[model samples]
Target chain A: MQAFDIEVTLGRTRVLHGVDFTAKPGQVTAIVGPNGSGKTTLLRATTGEIPFTGRVLLNGEDVARQKPWQLAAIRGVQPQSTTIAFPFTVVEIVRLGLTAGLSAANTDLPVRALEKVDLTGFENRMYQDLSGGEQQRVQLARVLTQIWQPMVDGTPRWLILDEPVASLDIGHQFTVMDLTRDFATRGGGVVAVMHDLNLTAMFADRVVLMQDGRIAAQGTPSEVLTDATLTQTYGCPIPVNTTPPVGMPFLLPQARMTREPC
Target chain B: MSLAVDAPSVHAPPMDRRVQARRLTVALSLLLAVTSVFSLAWGASGTSLWAAMADLAAGRELSRLDRIVLFDIRLPRLCLGILVGASLAASGAVMQGLFRNPLADPGLIGVSAGAGLAAITAIVLGAMLPPAIRELTGNYLVPISAFFGGWGSTLVLYRVATRHGQTSVATMLLAGIALGALAGALSGILVYMADDSQLRDLTFWGMGSLAGATWAKVMAATPIILAALAVTPFLARGLNGLALGEAAAGHIGISVQLIKNTSILAVAAATGAAVAVSGGIGFIGIVVPHLLRLATGPDHHSLLPNAALLGATLLLAADMIARVIIAPAELPIGIVTAVLGAPVFLWILLKRRGALGL
Candidate 1:
């Protein structure tokens, strides 16, 4: 999947500059940036949730020309938050994926997706009664149910998530990241906007760093997660360090007052 | 994170939802049947239900009085009650799903008030028209104008609520109230100009009754109401998708705009036709859907059909109470519905007070 020269203006404010992005099959691409840096806007445009000036191509077909049901067959999206006014049970919420527009034959996918999210017994519980973390996982289960198989007809399906792990506990964070990793390993493309730099470092094969509605850097973690780039883009001092076993780069913030004179 | 070793199996899958919906439909149908019989048997005309049934079974001819009272008077009233009731309830459920709020009712959104204003104008001022015009419309003028009035107000409210590509629920709610109040003020002015006889008609009509039911009125409204109800099942899947919110629903292949437009039009058509036939009947629209929502989860596939059935049954039951509560003199059907429905509405509010954000 690819986006070329995307530009968006919401009312009077130009929210996205001309931005280009790409997500390859069999890889997890992480988009990390500060708040209001156009990360979610970019994802929204690419997924056809919002209109933009540039072109988004999915499997060599222009998304703008495609019908919604046609798009539903190959991609699933998890928005930042879903506000459900009526009382819906967990399983009922998940079941919407099957009836939404996809003609997938898997009727039991909702339960299986719940089990994958460690929410097997929560099927009958009221969604409103669950905690923030549980609700986020339930949403993940919903999207997973939409695109149950990683690939169909030798073309990889895509999962576009916006802050997928923001409300999750540390354990569930790893659980969700592992699920994305597994999907990528099984030949699906996963593009996600992430707030946790460490998690992005651990799971992302490619990282795109954004600042002020523009991509400031894009590369492997070692190339994008450099000390100068982090400090410049975040407007704070962040030192980059490497883990022992995997040699993945992680950011460690240093207090300004404790730093020695350079 | 390491996965758990053992997970307890939740209880066996609950009753099949399809089976439950079918059972609900069957139960409501039986309830409606019983109420219709009661309505026919007992009326101010004092018909004996046992004798009527026995005579019919024996292939005996009914007396002229029985034929006039039963076939002409009671049957049409019963049919109108069912049609009006089902339309109101089904419209309520669709509106709630469209707005994603349980508090949304056709009355609250100004459709009833707008239709009421049009009907009142026709009642008080319609006599002043030339003979030819009056002769052209005859019995159908009030309903036709009422339908247009309801549709007009809804179109304006929708325009106010939606800007660019999005609809704001808060704006829609507040705008509906404003529009309703405006329509009411205009209706009051029309009432002031009415003479004594017109004033009496307006008062009785405002309170609502099935006493004026006629075969012509029923025939006029059946087409509109049935058309609206027939289109609801097709809207159910789109409404279910809408429960996920607009953007997510769009991602799932629903044309969000199409769903919103179709739902608004259907609700307007149903609510308009119902209000035109029976003036300002409240409670069924708001109360029936809430009761059904409590019984069944928010799946529109079942909720829409069940709402239509239960709405019809409850209205018929209420109409029956209106008939016998005063025996020889009939009470207004609207009063009985309010007396029964207001308490249920309050109970729901109290139970969900924390969630209501009131």
Candidate 2:
């Protein structure tokens, strides 16, 4: 799906200017920006959840023109914060995801979604009582449950994660990203809006840096996660370098406020 | 019949046993129907099962007393009970959902006080007119003035609740209390100025009744009741989402403002119609939904229907008991409900003890 220059004007305030992008199948497209940088707005506009100008094309059809249910059928999202007041079980909550775009005949979704996030046993437990990371995983389960149903000939589905791991602990953050990475690996399109630059550098197939409601940079991790963009984005001094500690992608921060010798 | 069994099981199988909004629907329907029939039979005439059956079945030429008792008194009164119970329950459920406070009532927005004040006005003013209209006073002045008063109070509540297209629950609650107090203050002024005879009439009217029920009144009320009932069930999915929180509901394809607006209109219509009929029958609206929660769970699909049915059950039985406790001398149904309800509530409070730490 390509967001063909979406324009959004809420009343008088233009939250998103004419923004253009392409989110392709079989790739991790990372949208990273500071707060109010139109990351969330862009996602919302792309999904047609909010009224916005410009067109979103899914399989070469205008996504905005499709019915809400039609659009929902092809896509699923996990927002920044999901507060569930009712004490529905994890499986119960996740089962709702399957309801958006599928027939009841496909009954394997609940178990598959739980298996995707490694939350199988936690199904019957109260959703609200789970830890933040566990709850985030449960939400991921819902998103997966909604989007990932086996097709007639055995195929995967598309997923969009809007800060899916924002509320999770560091370890669970990796688990979520790894899950998204696996999703992309299994021939699925995954768009992850994230703030963890290190995780983005490690897992992102392509990184798109957004600034002030516009794309500031877009390229592979090495090209986009340069010292200059990092400093500018964080409004602080930081060093961006590489290390071979078990070949993990590493960019350690040397200082908080001091600018690097560019 | 199969639809009831299959629909609930599909959404919620016994193996899963989670939330079944439809199960709640059927259960509430059953409760509402049975209790509504029972309410139709209870009155000063002690409408026997055989008699009510005979009355309906044989098209018996009902005795003049039975006609008066059925058509004029019990039937209208029964219709009013069902209407009032349904409305109050609907409004209260929506209020609880809108405010995200489980304990909130429709009258939290001051509609009751408004209706109460208007009833007082009708009573006080009827005396000034000749005794000619006194015969038609309950049949006339009461409902009209109550509807107007109920609408007036809710208009104020609506204005107070809406701010920047966002209704704050705390603000709405405060506005209701303040508006209610104002109505109460105005009511006190009327009470203070009343003569002894006016005072007696005002006090009794304030106690509330379905004794003055009429088919015309129920016919007038049925539309609003039907309207509330019809629109409310459709909102079950959205209300379930809304119960999560505003942001979450929005994320789940629900327009927050639309739901909030519908809630406002629903509360106004249901509470207005209810108060117009039975004056201010308090506490039932507050407690019925909670009691339903235990039996059917918290899903609005079930909660709402169960609330509607149990609300009927409670008011009907209370009204019936009011007729029988002092045989042929009818005490106000409101007095009976409050008197009976308060003890049950107290027992619950004591049994649970610190559970209601709120």
Each model's DockQ score: 0.58, 0.18
> What does candidate 1's lDDT look like per residue over B1-358, in tens digits?
1334343335546444556777888898898888878878878876777788899999999888888888889999989999999999999999888877787788767888888888888888998889999899877778777877887887888788766444566787799899989989999999999999988778866778888888988987898899999999999988888888888888887888889888988888888888888888887988998988788777899889889999988988899899889888899999998888889878977887777565
TM-score, per-candidate, Cα-based: 0.91, 0.75
* Residue-wise C-alpha lDDT for candidate 2, range B7-27, written one tens digit per residue: 654444334443455565676
- lDDT tens digits, residue span A189-215, model 1: 999999999889888999999988889
TM-score of chain A of each: 0.91, 0.85
Candidate 1 at residue B76, lDDT?
93
The Cα local distance difference test for each model comes to: 0.85, 0.71
Q: List the residue pairs that clash in candidate 1.
A: none
- What is the CAPRI rating of model 1's predicted complex? medium
